[model samples]
Target: MLSEASNFWGLFKSGSKEREFRKAVEQIIGEKPSNPLLYQLAFRHTSASKETNIGGFRESNERLEYLGDSVLGMIVAEYLFKKYPFKDEGFLTEIRSRIVNRESLNQVARKIGLEKLIQFDGQRIAHNRTSMYGDAMEALIGAIYLDKGFRFTRSFILKKLIANYFDLDAVIQTNTNYKSILLSWAQQEGKKIVFEIVQENGKHHHKEFVAQVKVNGEAISTGGGWNKKKAEQEAARRACESLEIKSTQ
Candidate 1:
């Protein structure tokens, strides 16, 4: 453990940076942070830095992101369970998935200024990977869990993150399942729809996928993502925007 003097000096040395971080946190979380290390790890991206200068095995925020993902899901589930006691399991699960999905999380993170605050190596790569901000948000949640315990983390997620950021009623009324939406519309219109993986590129550790959404044997739109499912989802979302207006279905 670091001595009090050492900790004080450490804070003194990092006073400027800490002030910046504190301001950012206040904007995001609506309060000053008691532990800043967790927030640091939350913004640290693997693409930007691999191994930390510290002696431990941690290289990036991947582990923290993993932990945060599970924790956030559980909290969302519990919140949904309590809020929608009469709703069935399927309804709760589907709504929870929408609330915690990559695109939705990324949107929330970007809206909360995390995209500007996130640390990464290159601008191009960082901008290209849309999920980076979302991943950082999850990792930050993990950090919050470790530093502030479950009660604080839960409040932050439900009250600050979900309540303030997301529109659950809008989400419930509108289906974000692009694939299902496309399929149902095509079926109603008596048209054929297909999603094909046209390309897969990137390093072994990180893969990029390009998916094309074809409607009635014509490629309507294309989108790329870190995974095929996400790519397909994007493609379908694009297809909906393009074809939806044209078809009454």
Candidate 2:
């Protein structure tokens, strides 16, 4: 299931495929899903979207991911607020961002065996499949919220995700903002650094951008992402790696 597969036959169909997928989801989430369609859509990447019979609407996880992003953010914020009663907003926000950032979520999704269930077009998005797993993780949270309720979803996130996958002390001590680090290094070294979008691919909602970093008019590194900012950060990350610039932030 890690590899890309074709689209689901229909939104309402409950065939063997759905059953298999349901079992897989149960193993990952440790709960039986009430509605299979939502969970199915949770792992469905945009490249693997299917056109519905009505209105020619393509069904993907984008909408679910949007909902899950907000839900996850709120849940994390609430948890951080309660756990660190004396901490300021800035500290909580930073912790939440570190926990929910693309690379962090991507690593968590892989650890939770989400890669086996995600369905994407490997051929179509071969080179730019950076954050699809993390996106799917958010979409899965949305599905869990809809399938269960807020209370159950909150518990699931707190117990199943944050408690299991993250160590708050380690997360607090780490800073992976490559762009900020690169900028700081450039400022200290008095070197001019620029990030340029070299290429853009895919549709409007599912666009992939390639960013190149140039220091003193010489291209240093290039990287890709689902958006421009991510792309730039990726490029900067590579530049940092190449230059052996350790993060000071």
Candidate 3:
């Protein structure tokens, strides 16, 4: 029952579950769904997927996900532009990114009760399925656009999704970009900030890097990751914690 059309529609002769799904869709979008197939595909994860023609595999809503990502970004950008007409580009960009980021979208999807609707492989990927939720959220946006057109999609996004899920004030007050926060604070306080790669190893596809963050030439903290940037970010995060730097980006 992993988002197959038949499974969704023909699950019960009574159509009780079908009615529930219909109600759920209406609740989520504030309108009746015109195209059920698109909604089905939006909830279909790659793990329990059907093969496509041309010898290709699209087990997930990845294509739709990509489309949704673009659509969501554009809508958010427009909202930000109109809402904060006087704010600078950096502030708008950061806030827009925060709204459309994976974690935020995942939370939004969960808030809208997409977890029960989304179909995925049972056990595998469940441990770290936050990205899956986020991806499905984007795919739903793509579905809305395709089924209802841009204007309706925009209304759903701005009036329903963003208005209900996204918190503008919290995002403006909080700073999740640890590296940027650390760098900016260091510059303000006249502290010399430097990042150095302490170690690098592993094969081409699975290389690992260890990085250290230094403040005033003293080792603040060290962290490791699959790439230098990731390692540096982790190191910066550790440094922020160690130095008690208030994350106000």
Candidate 4:
């Protein structure tokens, strides 16, 4: 365990870490952090624990990340629900998926300088994989919740993350299974549609499937997913959107 004195000195060393952390938090929340420790843990990567040897004594931000992930989901869900009062569950779920997915979270992390503060294993950092950085970002959010609390985290998410980064209105409208809609429309128009699974491979637990959607003997779209059904749905949606746009133009 780091003694109280050591913790103080560690924070005081160059002050830059704390400063950067504060800046990031401010950028996210639109205000300075009330709790310094929360900001510190928000940037505390698991890799740093290995270096300090007090790894066991000082907890990683994983727990906080888990909490933050849940909190983030709820917040986004609620926002969507209120913003688009008329949207159905399926539409709401798709919009949430687009907003909270790996790519979206990474974009938020990068925008807030979370990437620079991450402390990860050198090898993993050098490789620059998605899972590591994505997990680290979630862990940081979790830490923020623990250190500061939900109100502040929500403030940061809404004002900085959501308002500044994402086009919530546009996402809600467009982030949908267009293939499904297109297929439905085609069938209504007395057209036949089919989705064929072309390939399936990967470990049993993590297998992926590729599917193509066809209409009237013409291939309309292709997509991949963890399962055949999902892949087909995605392809169908894409095909529908493309065909619709072409017809209108």
Candidate 5:
């Protein structure tokens, strides 16, 4: 009787597993997987191994994450360079930071609903950290690269990710502050401009301060920086740019 029950359980479990596997494949490839086993392995988190019974033959996405990191960096760097030929190194670095930061990558992952399909144990899944999700997203990209080749992956990134979310012009323009220059100009023109440090946080050596610049009793702009002078300058620079103050006195 026990042997018969075991056989029945195995048959039912196999069918259920196949259905779940197919759903995961559909989610990743946007269609049924030709190689269903590969899709199954891709979705298998290290923690879920014991239940899946795949043994040591299956590999986790860690290696894929490493490859994807390099690929993403290269792709984003190339894209930025070609898009902004006139941009200097410092300017380019800042824009890249905004684009490839942890928050940015997580946003991209959430946009694609990649988080829902991630397989993990209850404890690991419960944490729901941004870094974990972002890592998985990168690993998925690497898997896609391996499966579909570079051209397809690149086109997908351009169409589905870059074109849909990122705005090149907006990123470049907001890279730096011009308000400080305007404040200086106003002062030189015998006009009054005041920069008040409203708040400060962090240690003395690594302090961050927020400053608001006001011109003739009207608040022009606010900026944050590592120091009072820099913060004030950023605020003033922004004010100048916004107001279109031309004279650089």
Candidate 6:
């Protein structure tokens, strides 16, 4: 935790470029970062990474993104669990996915001004920016978690990101319905689609179902869930991604 006076003096002493980045981050997150280096690492894209240590190890936001992904999922899961106490596991899972999906993260990241701070090879990723902003968003979460710990990070997510950007009613009402979309696409393309329960684990209420979607007798994708329908829907969603089929929603 940097004192306000120290933070201002530190910024005053830093290089012009460093001061700019620090100020930008402070504006985005609504606080002075205790450790600015973490934020710097968080915005570093792999495209602009350089080998920094032993063997082919490079410094980039990937590791932070991985950590942030888990943290984000847990936070969202807990939020959904409490917000919709009457909802089942499937409902919670689906809603969580909708909230943290790549597209949603990307949109949120851009909306929060991360796109300007992310250090990426623009020419290299000019056509592949879909996941870039989203990845940096996760990394930023990880950095926040490290710097401020879970409680503060959670508050920031719920208050700053979720409260400002997400509409719970809208998210709940919107249906991508990947299964229906995949089926319709299969019918139009004359491809036979079959969803089969490949595996079931555990017993009773805790059991998990794995569904595999096969097209023309070959497996296209597989998904797992607490129920058969949800598992098949996940498989359909993956298959749609593989087939480049856009959702109607």
> Best-fitting candidate, measured by lDDT?
2
Compared with the true structure, all predictions reach lDDT values of: 0.79, 0.85, 0.81, 0.66, 0.64, 0.83
Task: At residue 159, give the lDDT of candidate 6.
Answer: 97
TM-score of model 1 (CA atoms): 0.77
lDDT at 228 for candidate 4? Answer: 71
lDDT of 2 by residue, 1-249 (tens): 223343433322556766777887888778889998899889888877889998999999999999999999999999999999999988889889899888888989989988777777755665245688899999999999999989988988899999999999889878787887898899999999999999998875467899999999999999988889899989999999999999764
Ranking of all candidate structures by their lDDT, best first: 2, 6, 3, 1, 4, 5
Superposed on all Cα atoms, the candidates' RMSDs to the truth, in angstroms, are 6.4, 3.7, 5.0, 7.7, 11.5, 11.3
RMSD to the native, candidate 3? 5.0
User: What TM-score goes with each of the models?
Assistant: 0.77, 0.80, 0.77, 0.60, 0.54, 0.70
Selected candidate, larger lDDT, 3 vs 4: 3
Candidate achieving higher TM-score, 1 or 5: 1
lDDT of 5 by residue, 1-249 (tens): 222212332342477856865665466446555555444444445544433356545466566777777777777888888888998987677777667655567778777766555555543333243254666667766776777777766776677778887887775555333544564577677778877999897654246789997888888788877667667766776777677776332
Candidate 5: deviation at residue 146, Å? 0.4
Please report the candidate that would top TM-score against the real structure: 2
Query: In model 5, how large is the Cα lDDT of residue 22?
Result: 66
Output the TM-score of candidate 6.
0.70
RMSD of 4: 7.7
Off by over 4 Å in 2: 1-17, 184-194, 201-208, 214-221, 241-244
Which whole-number lDDT from 0 to 100 does residue 94 have in model 4? 78
User: What value of lDDT does candidate 6 attain over all alpha carbons?
Assistant: 0.83
Query: Where does candidate 3 stray beyond 4 Å?
Result: 1-16, 127-129, 186-235
Model 5 RMSD vs true structure: 11.5
